[model samples]
Target: MSYPTSSSPRMWWTCTYAPGAQPFRGLIVPVLEEWSKSNVSDAFPFLAPIDHLLGSRRRISINLAKLFNFFDQEIVQRRLARTGSGSGSEKNNDVLDILLERHAMSKLTRQEIITFLTDMFIAASDTSTVTVQWAMAQLLRHPEKM
Candidate 1:
């Protein structure tokens, strides 16, 4: 099948679906800023309490709470959309949709589902880097298989 040059697995949604307004686009920078700073406890485990006293923990909590709230909002909105959209509506098989589908069968708790998305978001870049390195190592070791 032919594909657009600008599209890949990552951009498939945008390629096939019309663009929608992104109201949260502006709020992302501050979230990045909050996450950019390394946690003190990460470097010095014994000094964990210092983070609480110095307000580092508070900042992290506020940022995470904001992020979690956004996730919660998205979940609710998706539920409404799925319910409101009859069979005529195009089905979206995104991660949240899949998780909600499982949730419908009582397979996952809201917290567990939300954690999956958050972990994916937090580790996506790091995971990609490691994945490429691992693939390269495997390819070099198994050229015959390749």
Candidate 2:
């Protein structure tokens, strides 16, 4: 299956002021795909040793951290700039705005905002893609149902 086209816009609308660009797609899609792949260590505890030997878990963690940093730099910084500038035109009505508001009030740190935005993107994009894939598969298998 191809990558979810809607995921980029959805994540941009939800967390970034710069919706025109979708640099995060490169990082997010592959990371999520890698994460979704089943690993032998998951099925057998004894295989965990080999996972470390293969550096699989370490690679995943590093990629996740990279994804998190991308979201932080792209989304969080843009939101902070817009909110900090006190410009009405830059105002956002999305989750990022709420998180930035919290950041302004000292209720959340920069890292927390980044983490929340990353989590939101991953959860929303993955869920939407899986749901669409399942629906398409069902329709293909049972044309009469559609």
Candidate 3:
């Protein structure tokens, strides 16, 4: 999770967050939560027409756009750093760097890079590993609850 950075004085760096920083209270969590739920269209495919009226589908689209935009900005920032315009370098300092390296050679498309970043972000999120940690913390807080 820690990426070595040439930026002196800072021993290491993180791709998504600072140590002990809870950043999941953001658009990513909401969009993911919405996606995890059962949609009306999932139950009845023909009712897709009513999706517009229901507005749930539109909400997901909007959130997804925002999510993609977030990743796009991250990519641009990392690309700048990788090119020496920002604090990063062309070296494989992080996953983004590796992806961008391949990207520069046309080995990967922009969409593919973004998708990989999205997966990495999601995997780094609390929706998986942190779930167990959180449950243990809660159990310790209220021993009777366990």
- Residues 1-146, candidate 1: write the lDDT tens digits: 11122222132121222345432332333445555567788899998898778886677677667767766777777777777867524447766777888898899988887777656555542455557779999999999978
Clashing pairs in 3: none
Q: How far is candidate 3 from the true structure (C-alpha RMSD, Å)?
A: 8.1
How many angstroms is residue 35 displaced in model 1 relative to the true structure, after the best TM-score fit? 4.7
Please give the lDDT score at residue 29 for candidate 3.
Answer: 63
Steric clashes per prediction: 0, 0, 0
Clashing pairs in 1: none
Please give the RMSD of candidate 2 to the true structure.
Answer: 3.9
Point out the worst 10-residue segment of candidate 1 by lDDT. 1-10
Arrange candidates, best TM-score first. 2, 3, 1
Ranking by lDDT: 2, 3, 1
Q: Tell me the tens digit of each residue's lDDT in model 3 across 21-121.
A: 43333556666666666777789988877866877777888877777776677678667666774545555476666677799899999899877766655
lDDT by residue for model 2 (1-146), tens: 44664455453455443666667776777777777877888999888888788877887788888887776676656666676887734755666667676877999998887777677767866787789889999999999997
Report the number of the highest-TM-score candidate: 2
* TM-score of candidate 2 on Cα atoms, chains taken together: 0.70
Q: Is candidate 2 or 3 superior in lDDT?
A: 2
